[model samples]
Target chain A: MPPRPRRSYDQFCAAARALDAVGDRWTLLIVRELLLGPRRYTDLHADLPGVSTDVLASRLKDLEQSGLATRRRLPPPAAAYVYELTGRGRELTPVLRALAAWGAPELAERRPTDAVRAHWFALPLLDAVALEEGLVELSLEEGDFHVRRGSDGTVSYGDGPAPDEPDARMTLDAGTAVELGRGTLSVADGVRGGRIAVTGDGPLAKALRDG
Target chain B: MPPRPRRSYDQFCAAARALDAVGDRWTLLIVRELLLGPRRYTDLHADLPGVSTDVLASRLKDLEQSGLATRRRLPPPAAAYVYELTGRGRELTPVLRALAAWGAPELAERRPTDAVRAHWFALPLLDAVALEEGLVELSLEEGDFHVRRGSDGTVSYGDGPAPDEPDARMTLDAGTAVELGRGTLSVADGVRGGRIAVTGDGPLAKALRDG
Candidate 1:
């Protein structure tokens, strides 16, 4: 099939070019979903909530062409097509962090029209995990996800509790997590108020508790 | 007048919220234009080629409502409406940087449809300035601009040479600058190639020379 045309900015600037590739609607959020690891199409649609199936499929194809993501059939027993980010695609961790930091204040209140998901809260709280390398399982009122902050600087998270024992584990409500993410509440303040719970004897746990 | 509705993802996640504000077409490019300091509407139009007037106006209005930009008339002597980024809006610098860093490699070739502006190159090159807190005036074959890398980690640059004496001055062609921005070439490599000419004995200049 002929590729879908890209509505590029047609600018020589790097930022403009980046926007040309990922500036389309739902693209970065799709990146957010895959950052958690490989996900089947249905899982992505479930987490994203509002994107149209056609748009999702189009974006996945675009991401694949842009070399940001890849799609392949899973081997054997649990076979299904899945999409995952390439190393270059995973480099958006800092961009995600910056966006989360910039937008945390805007999240003062959830509108009646807003959809909620627990792992949706993961990107904002990823930086707070503070582990140089290791898995940190997060338990939230809505759900749980284990974020693996790599020493190489890519941050990835997967659904459910940590598959293996985690380096650190944190439990907090969405409300408190947002507050902490926004700096409306500090780590020490969250700990003092019992809004945040930290476990595990690892440095990240100690850092979270002692902060 | 009633505000135009925001086409949000309707997701409560902060990154999603941010995307709701910025993910629109030309919104961030507008931010990019304003980051060089206040710009007259016509000037912005000139610099941001390929943006339709209607789209520009809409993006500007959206930016204003989202608190990323503001519009105001200049004082009597040089009166003209100008748009500038708010402090909160300027916080996207890191996001811009990360995007630039990630997208730099894609700039391998400028397409036939691509437009070029000397200042458009400033944002990606801002970080290579290196000093903790200093101004580095860059003179390129296409034009000149000065970048101020603040101690607080904010990188802002403007058109023309530095208003005051810069800590360092470097003259290079845009091709070499692109290489440096893309990470394919280092500042040290550029200097060694004599593609870059650095002046002034300030720490930044000395560091660039030493590097």
Candidate 2:
């Protein structure tokens, strides 16, 4: 990428550079809420009730200044303002979805079922992305699990038993499988160590290894 | 967005939901750091020196579970992990960039220049989308300000005297112009109120109205 004019930076690391803008806890969550649609200030406040009005105002100002959101006045005498993600802001949906998917299982494990329902803003991003063709089914005798595609390039998590005719199959405990999905451990290594098992096409098996 | 799979409500939004399988906070920051390139865990620790080893280990687990990053075991049996973003994780570059840009000005205002530099991950997204083409020069008595569209679609902000061959001219104070950029007031309103003066191209004048 070419250098941004006027903005000066001595650091060479890109991630550090990115953190300089969004490292705050509220900002990414705000981006996540905007992915759903344009919202009024009160609407955003309701969605993220934990955020103070002042902080929301500041974040909105920052977002507009950075050109991620455009704030427009609504029609009539309401004097209300609507904040919509610019095209640039909308592009962040995928990152938020992937992050949500990665976090869901742990979230499920931590909270009781009754409490999770209140979180309207916490939906995963994959739900918004178009799912790709081909399905993979896997079953374990004992475990709670979710699946994410290495090849489909859409990161998501699902509940319950895998479909009957998936393109491939792998069986492992929930935690270990999630670890594999995260790319922390290689499938080949896991298989060699007896942490995971395969029961499908050899090519698909190899593909998992490659992933 | 599709409904979340069967589970009760509380499970949905707790810290568990927010926390990735890799862990929370630090992992995302670590991934944001690696999105630029690979780095040793110690180097990552340096970027976020406040994080303890136990916390770092936990965060690495969560990041690995999310597939946003990968840890390669390097040579000589050193048992060290060098982390880098995966193809999926790299997609977050723009999001990180936007956050950096949003935080930069405030970080500068609050902290000394020598404090950790503000990262600018959002610049690419801004350059890719928000910028509009064409030059609109606003000439003030103190000095002229130029807003021009770059080939890449980024809006350039510069300070200097007016150019001789200007397509249009508008006289306004710098502070008011910045306020307009914030969407707090309208340029046409300002002009009608005699706070600003416009000359030259009619279409350019209209563009400023829209802006």
Number of the top DockQ candidate: 1
Each candidate's DockQ score against the native complex?
A: 0.79, 0.11
Question: Compared with the true structure, what per-residue lDDT tens digits does model 2 show for residues B1-211?
Answer: 5432422223243222443232234555665556536678887776664578888876775566567678897787676768877776665544444344333333322223322422222232223212245555555444544555657854433334334454456677644443443334576677777777766665555555444
Task: Write out the backbone clash pairs for model 1.
Answer: none
Could you give the C-alpha RMSD of every candidate to the true structure, in order shown?
A: 1.7, 17.0
| Model 2 residue B167 distance off true place after TM-score fit, in angstroms | 53
User: Which candidate leads the pack in lDDT?
Assistant: 1
For candidate 2, what is the DockQ?
0.11
Residue B115 miss distance in model 1 (angstroms): 0.6
